[model samples]
Target: MVDSLSELMIILNRTYKEGNVFKKVVKQIPEVEAAKIGEISKRISKAKQTVFEATAHLDRQVWQETKTSAQQGRIAAEATRKTAHDIRARVIDLQQETSEGHDKLSSQVDQFRSQMVDAADQMGDQLAQTKRQITKDGEERKQFEAGLQRLVDALPASIHEQLQSALYQFVADAIVQRQLFALPSNIISPNSPPLPLVQYAQVLSESDIINLLQTPDPIGDADRILRKESLMSDEALGYATLLRQKRQFKEWLSSDWPSLVLVDGCSRGESVGRTSPMSFFTASFASTLIRAETGIVLQFFCGHHIDPQKENSGPKGLLRSIISQLILYPKSYNLSLNFVDQGLYDAVAASNTEALCYFFEKLFWQIQPDTIIYVLIDSVSDFESDLHDYGERMDRVLILFQTLIGQVLQGFAAGPKLKLFMTSPNRSHRLIYRVDQAKESIRLNAAALGDISRSGERSLREIRRARSPLSYIM
Candidate 1:
């Protein structure tokens, strides 16, 4: 039993040692598990660190963007404020300029209105002045016309008075008296009541003479000649001679009774020669009268041909030509009338019988007071061969002569001693008998002219030898 107990003790000791070793191994395993867990925890920590860094970077970028956007918005607001201020200033300037312009326009309108009023006032004054001027001119013209009328009326009257005065002076100064021929007893007696002196003319009415002249017929040789019709007609043959005298005197009065006078015979048939008996006698008488008076003017106008049948041989043409000559005479004579103004000379020279009377009246009024005039008409019947035409022409002349004679006589208290002398180729002239109350009709032959020229100076035979036709005797 002892031995068996010993062996069991040994085995128990060995098992106890093995159990201690297993306990040690279990403790070491637990330590190793704890170390592994520590390593895994370190790895997880590093991953979390990386994720945090990335999130921080994204947040920083977002903050920077927000700041830049806010700054740009503020700058835009400032620029808008500046633009608004500039626009306000411009509006204020425009209003001020408009106000100034309106005021200037108003001032100009006022000035223009003042100027218009002044112009209207001036126009009214000018109109009044023009009206006054027109009124003044009208009054002056009326006065001028009145003066002209007075002058015209006085002209003839003054001339008649002057001629009467001249005649009176001449009568007082003249010593020798030349008398007209004594009247024949058969024709007119000293006591015969002046048979109506106008009865000598077949047609005494002035109207009849006018009618004859106005009738439109050619003035032919037959009209101018003393045809059988005229001789056989109721009118006396001497009527033509009276008619001729009338026309000659009327023309002479119109011519202002020229200082130079011409007396002529316008005979038809070859009577004596060309010289007129009346002309020769007048020339001799004038020569004698001129010796007595220094202021007497005398001239002779003669016809071209004694025969009326010859061409251009009328007394009318010769008389007109003589007046033209006087008109053209240079005003060299001391006593010549001043006719240079208003073409007076030419106008008077060209005037017809009526106009000539007016001109003569005016001209004669201006002549010297002492001038004496003597007019002698010869062979009045010789004016035209046709007695009827000659009588017609003479009617107007006779009326004019009557007027002039009456005016001259009226101008003087004692009656102007004016004398008229006439000669006719025909002895049958009734006018001579009718007109000459104080004188007689003397038959003046060619020989009678010589007797007057050399009366008591030459023998009758010598005078006969010297005598030619009446025309040559002058």
Candidate 2:
């Protein structure tokens, strides 16, 4: 019973101790709550500061972007103003230039009008003078005819009969000559002859002969066509002058018989001016022949390295150009074109080489007996092109001349006399050989030219002035 009492007292003591522990925990609750509230206030203050800093950073970015945009807008506005000013200035300049051009054009037009008016007045005066001269000529002709009739009537009966017969014969001859001179209008055909002589005449008046031949004009120094400026060099002129003084050359010029003179520049050494100088010599000689007015001068300056239609540098173009020049020759002669028959016209229209040769032969036969025809063909070597069959073609050209010369020799008693003058360079041995075969051909080598290169050189301007048409008349 005493042991149980001791255990109950020990329990009571332990319960008292646990009660003390509870009281102590209860007392620390207020301090713990105070500490937690202080920590929460600090956290709230930090959060407020962070939000303020973020808002301030956003405001600064917005202000900077606005300032940049304002600056760009100001720059763009200035650029636009500058562009507008430049455009206005450009427009003003263009307007001023246009006004000046218009004024200059108007002034030119006024000057042209005045020149045209003066030309018209001069033409009118010339026409009036021509009409008066024609009237005077007609009156004189009438008076002469009346006087002749009175003289015939006053003659004796037997003498009058003879005079009347002679007068009738003269009138008939005049009528026949007139008929010969008339244009070949009667020979025109619808299907065959594409262009009649009359129409061809019109074309000749409007266009150059080179265009009709469908051949490029012979290339020269400054012009395509052979002009005085480009025709001859000083050395060539001296050679030509020297040649003209030669007894043989003068004989050829004055010869009544048909002849072929082949000038071979090839016979001499390389230094003998056998290239362009040879061409110049031939051209100068031809010009001299033309100025002499001895006969109809037909010239063909063969071109080298011609492309596309290389045949034009050969005999085909030569014949065609000759026929063309013949048709236009004696520009003052009032002849009805009786010579150009339908066949010849057709051949010319067709441009058939063989036919042209045939018709040319016939035309040559038809020329007035005793009339001299000079054919000057320069640079015979230039007939050869890059054509595969160039040799054959060149042979054909040589054969054509041979045939013509043969015909002339055969018909020595009849037909018009033809004088063929040809020039060749030094390299063309074959051509020189072929030409040398002609019995009637008179060959003049570079030795005949006689140091013409050593002669004084004349300026091209001087040559042109010297070769002027007025110089020829003088």
TM-score of 2: 0.46
Per-residue CA lDDT of model 1 for 266-357, tens digit only, reads 32232324333333433433444444553332233222223445322333323332233223323322222332223333333343343334
RMSD from true fold, candidate 1: 41.8
Clashing pairs in 2: 181-335, 181-336, 182-335, 182-336, 182-337, 183-336
The per-candidate count of clashes, in order, stands at 18, 6
* lDDT of candidate 2 over 1-474, digit per residue (tens): 234445545544543545465223334335555565556567667777998999999999999999999999999999999999999999999999999999999999999999999999999999999999999999999999999989878888899888779999999988656444332333222222232443333222313433445643332421222344343444444444444445555666667877776665553232223245445556555666666787777777664433436545455666676766665566444323344545555665666666555545544544565678888777676665535455555566566656655555686335567888776654564565665444434444555555443322333234455653123221
Off by over 4 Å in 2: 1-167, 170-250, 267-275, 310-312, 331-347, 384-413, 436-474
Cα lDDT of model 1 overall?
A: 0.40
Weakest ten-residue segment in model 1 by summed lDDT: 175-184
CA shift at 50, candidate 2, in angstroms?
99
Candidate 1 lDDT at 468 equals 17
